[model samples]
Target chain A: MHQIKTLSNRIRKNTGVDSIRCYQCGKCSAGCPLAGDMDFTPNTVMRMIQVEEKETDKKLLQSEAIWLCLSCEMCISRCPMEIDIPKVMDFLRQESLKEGLQNKSANHNIIPFHQSFLDMIRFTGRSYEIGLIADYKLRSKKILQDITLAPQMLMHGKLPIFPKAVKNRKNIKEIFKKTNML
Target chain B: MKKKLGFYPGCSLEGTAKEYSESVVSLSEQFDIELKQIPDWNCCGATAAHNLNKTLSLVLPSRILAQAQKNEMKEIVVPCAACYNRLSVTQYELLKNDQLKATVEQAIDMPLNTSIRILNVIQFIQEYILPEIPEKLSHTFDKKVACYYGCLLVRPHNILKFDRPESPQFMDEIMQMLGAETIDWPFKTECCGAGLSVSRTELVGKLSGKIVREALDRKAEAIIVACPMCHANLDMRRPAIDQYLEMKTEIPVLYITQAIGMACGLNERQTGTRRHLVKVIGNYFTKTRIPVENNENNPITVEEII
Candidate 1:
């Protein structure tokens, strides 16, 4: 019971967005392009956060809406309350990850994509596209997807054969460690 | 004083959007805009870092800004809108919150300089290209263009402050000056399924399809964009978009830099015209010859029409 009350308070402290501020205008969901694809719409997620019940709070974190959010600012731009829904979405995603509540119902390898992207930056201090894509494909098991486009992209000099690494590898590792990303 | 603008070409510039990098560099050379590449700069972590870890996101961009500060660079021309947004947003956030700034500095292990101005590609052009180069253009970009300003360039209006969030005219104005007919269309600041490009490609097809369909409906010949992600989805994802639309609404998507390069009389290949997945045809190069003949890249003066 006590934990449920802290959810909304933590959201305010972390993202500066108060769940209670939402007036259920449905403006955020109305503007969201990914609203149809999400397990819960933006407005529904806001409502759930406002409810602050144990079940709804857990479901809110478990919902795929947070991951689906583009953080495009379409909602915040249109919101009457001017609540930063994108910021709230980010906070929810981190919370979702902490609880291992990432939903895999949708055919979206979003987590793998994020992991592969971070791995590229963490290793070389710069993104190695070839490495990133290969790693993503392997992790997500979507190897055949976009295979045809690779040769065309390579021929056009769009796909670099080699990754350009940043000179200071030590600094990148240190930064990662200090940020608790290690 | 050395007149060099710091250039931080994000990961995409090195890969999928190599043409963008090429066109920008070529255009800079023609204008003699001494663009100094930030020495040993890292990736800005992008949407991935922000989605997963909060501090990692700020630190990544902070490190890049810190590197720019080492060279005493005042402004960095971030060609990628995503990178520009991240850098600008990080600067805005860190500058406002000292506690967060201290945490970011500790993580980055570098002296943060959030005061350095971060300019997007459009702003970069408005500052450098539009000043003196427009008059000297050997060729006119006499094509109808829908200037696409994806999410990051102008959205989250409070932080980015460059153009109007919804109906931005900066890109259109620049295109109009280049002698291209600019169309007033919806979805100017719309999301183009940016990072979900590879993961959920079908969604990108549907999302980016709307932008293309509207442009084609309005009779826009080509879509001009300033961001690499927009280009990838709009151009590289053409096959998917076409499949989704169930019609071959194929149109060339050119980077703002590439369009400028073509207007400066550089050939289609020089401006990375060949790199496009949906082949860039129709008024591909300069239609009329100009008087300027000295510059190696500039068009030669015509004696007569063959």
Candidate 2:
């Protein structure tokens, strides 16, 4: 059981959230709104990190739990030790992508959603709802999923037809590169 | 005296939540306040960036803050809780960690150093409007309402320090100022599944549906919120929510600004209330959107729409 590159070690390095400090109080899981939708509850995920077993770590990475986190911060708000579980969830999601071990079935659309969001920002430097929806539909192939809502949104002026850009979109593209998102 | 405050409407404010932006702007205008958009501001890199990369989240907000600093804005009003949280959290993260701040500064190619106060919509109202609200009120909003804080505005309590983490009272207090009856409810600070409303509609249905349900059971006439994300989940996703709960819920979700605007004599169209998916009922929400021959020239004013 090497300590350096383990999920706990990496999460600690990135977020400064020590999973070792999580006392398995189950308070986080209890408060989390999305706990029902998750494959692994927050407390169970914390316990797996505490155990630090290779099998559990691998299983956790591929699990849909990481992507399911809403980052609602309910867990940390209730946690006695003030463990930042939401931050840990973010790190785990990033790791899941790096290893290409993200759950293919349950949480497949989550990645596409995030990618489209980043792409929207990278190009326009502002969120373009129409652009985001169109790109997400292309990626997720749920083209007609919310197609009906568009006309209503446009009519109400909820969805702007053109993308809003910062005066300097060139800078935004460079940010994606520097952050290694490109 | 028109006091100037930097404005960062965020993406949702410009798009899906333009009504929120409109209400905020019109409401501020009535108070003789000027909200200038922070020059060439970029996206705050919202829930998506934080979910995948911390640096990107920090960098995106850093650019906005840098521009604010460059413009010499002493304080800026961020109407969106998600944007407020991101800017506040990034500032907290950057102030303490010079190393991370330096990296973000390099990425944005600007100085990260800033002390420009970032104020959420609630704080903005409390600071500027609340003092003079009693004097400016054209009428009181007498509806029974639930003040839904959602998350982000109050959570990460150690850093945000805006209100109580779980049971926040700021929005409630503001609603009280508008002469609205604020209901006592448990889900005031709960998660509304705002981040996933677009991609995970079912989950949002369950989460936001529960909030709306709680408000309904308590006999609230409206669910008042300050964040666009919360409004999107509670208002725009009403169909999914009705589907989830197996019941139609029509209690309108109003941004705090919209409620405040109505108090100051701004009509439903002026506050963009007609744009809401759920037709807001009652005397206050009576205007309907009307088509024009040339919308660009005949910008939809309150009188014209009414």
Candidate 3:
């Protein structure tokens, strides 16, 4: 929870908007699309900051609620004094993760697909959908869960069984090699 | 007289989103511009790169920057929002930090080329193409469109300066050039949960469906986007979006270029209209890639490619 102080201090210095200005008006919560799915609504997040309550729910860290914020400026725009609530929330999420607190709501076991995606870009400087999907299915077990759907996708000509690589993979790879992204 | 810039098509041009890319390229030709494909240009480590390693995030796009610099091109035009962000952000980081420049150049084994411009196709059309509008547009796009800037393009505004991070209008300006009515909606620059789409399909589906619904409720004839991922979500994933939300949303999502292409008298095929998932809003387009080279006097053709 050391990140709480870090997040608060950063918000105060950076945004210059007092978290105490919020009076639980619920406008932020009323406007949020993911309010029903959140453990803590936007107003609650603001209230949490006001009371400096030690959040018992470590779920805040692992929750996709933080990342799910569109940063649409709706919450801030609707605020009476225009406090930058989304930025404060973002800093909270970033600091929370830095302190080993993560939102489990956002975490999934899709590392292979995610990793293969990066690998494709790293190797060719572009994605090869066929290669990425193949590598993903080869590495992940969940593809079997949806094995029934892949054929259907291919049947519709939606998913090409074979994807073409960028005509100049070397040049593209050089961009990756240069960035150390490869 | 012609303005020429390096072009990086990313994956969409060669495959699913090929139509959108082709139309933009052809549109550029009409503007007296040459979009020279950056020889050996590659992807910019879009949604995947940053998700894997933060380091690869910068490195992947930095490689493309280096290649363009090596080709002696001062600017590179990216049509995809994800690619544009990766390229623009890498350019910003290198220009901002000298140490990063040296380190990146050392990694790519190329001399750093600093002064390169990173422009999204939307920005290019807004800055370059829109000016030529009065001459070309015979019809006005009187339909309402929700201009979806999406996450990668405007977020991290330090990299892409086309518009406000929270409420962007680069696409709006382009839409206006086409004489389309636009709605000032909340989710214009919002994230479509695109990065989470593959792993968390239901979540993305619900979220994307909501965006579509919002646009539809506002009576937008279409949802306009500059990102391929956003296009995929709002267009290709509509079936899942509808299934998850338990509502039908048939509103079409068009790339900003596709709309511009339409106004320019270019048909659906030229704009990648056929590749979209939702029903094509206007004339049906046969999917085909225009040959890289076309004579100026002849109108571009779009033949269905099997």
Candidate 4:
């Protein structure tokens, strides 16, 4: 119970969203684009955190809602209480990753995709479209998903063959190191 | 000194949205606004970083802001809606929290200055380009356009505070100035499932598919967008969108700058209109003529029209 309280407090502080302020309005879930796909609705996640039940907390972390959130801020935009639901979702995602909580749903590649994006950023100081696509495809094994579109993008000069590195990549690496992303 | 704005094109400009970069450059050139690219800027950590690490999300944008300040840039224009949102939110966060600012400053190893103004393309146009529309424009768009704001440009209203989060009209007003009959669409500020264009292509298709369908149903000739990610999702991922919709929708997704650039008598090449996956603007451009002033000294040449 103490450990759960400490975790909830940390998340509350990190996200700056007072979960207790939520009255289960369900506006966040209504406005969410991916709400239908989420295992747990945005409002339910908030409630679970507010309730601070260990089983609910575990379920919230393990649910596919964290990974499925678009973070489009639509839910908060429509929320009457002006709650930052997306921020809470962000906190949940980080927490889930930190604790190595396995996502309930199978075949969701958002985690690997996010990892590839960060990896590309760390390597080149910016996102390399070609590299990110390759890495994500390799990880997700969805090789032929957008294969047809690649030729068109290349023709339109949308996908550059080589990645452009920033002037001081060493500095970017240092920032990553300090942030413990390394 | 000439009026200049610090330009942060973000990673999308370098790849996947080169046309946006081209059109912005040409549009700025015509408007006499010097765009100084920020020196040694890194990624803003985008949607991915913020989900993984909160500190990294703030730090990446702060570093860019710090570099912009070092370059003596008072006002910065971030054309990409995603980049603008990240930078604007970071600025808002830093202004509201001193500890976070100090931590970010420490992370970046630079003195932070939160006074720099970050402007989205719509805001930039409203401030700088709208007033000069009459004199600069040689042709009117005259076609009905659905200006898609997507999600990042207008949401999280308190932090961004640019236009109305629910129904933004800055882009519509700008399109109106270009003589485009802007449609009153419902999905103007809808989410296009931005970063999921690759990870969850079907979801993007479903979300962006609805937006495209809304535009088409309302008889919008083209869907004008300010964000590169929106363009990539809506334009590049058309097959998925088409598959999801179960119909062939060929509406041209144009950057707001590209639309404005063409209205200013710039040719298709100058505005990077030829790079679109679905070619819809060619007919409109071929039909419209650049209204030339009848002056003895400044004769209208055929080359200008072609």
Ranking, TM-score, top scorer first: 1, 2, 4, 3
Candidate 2 wrong stretches, greater than 4 Å: A1-4, B284-306
Model 2, residue B262: distance off in Å is 0.3
- Residues A1-182 of candidate 1 have per-residue lDDT tens digits of 45435578889988888889999999988889989998899899889888878788888887778888988889998899998888988898898888888877422498899999999899999888789999999989988999899988888788888889999999999988988887
Question: Ten consecutive residues with minimal summed lDDT in candidate 2 chain B?
Answer: B291-300
- When sorted by lDDT, best at the front, the candidate numbers are 2, 1, 4, 3
lDDT tens digits, residue span B1-306, model 2? 799999998989989999999999988887889999998999999999998887898999999999999898889999999999999999999999989888998998988666889999999999998998766665567778999998989989999998899889988988887678899999998999977887889999999999999999999998999899999888889899999999988788888888888766677766888889887766542222322221223222222232
Docking quality of model 1: it rates as high
C-alpha positional error of residue B119 in candidate 2 after TM-score superposition, expressed in Å: 0.1
User: lDDT per residue, candidate 3, B65-146, as tens digits?
Assistant: 7778878888778888777777876777778888877876666666776678878876687778877777766446667889
Overall local distance difference test of candidate 2: 0.86
Candidates' C-alpha lDDT? 0.86, 0.86, 0.68, 0.85
Off by over 4 Å in 1: A1-5, A106-108, B284-289, B295-306
TM-score of each: 0.95, 0.94, 0.75, 0.94
lDDT of 3 at A81: 65
Q: Which model scores highest in DockQ?
A: 1
* Residue range with the least summed lDDT across 10 consecutive positions in model 2 chain A: A102-111
User: What is the TM-score (0 to 1) of chain A in model 2?
Assistant: 0.94
- Write candidate 4's Cα lDDT for B238-269 as tens digits: 98899999999989998999888877766667
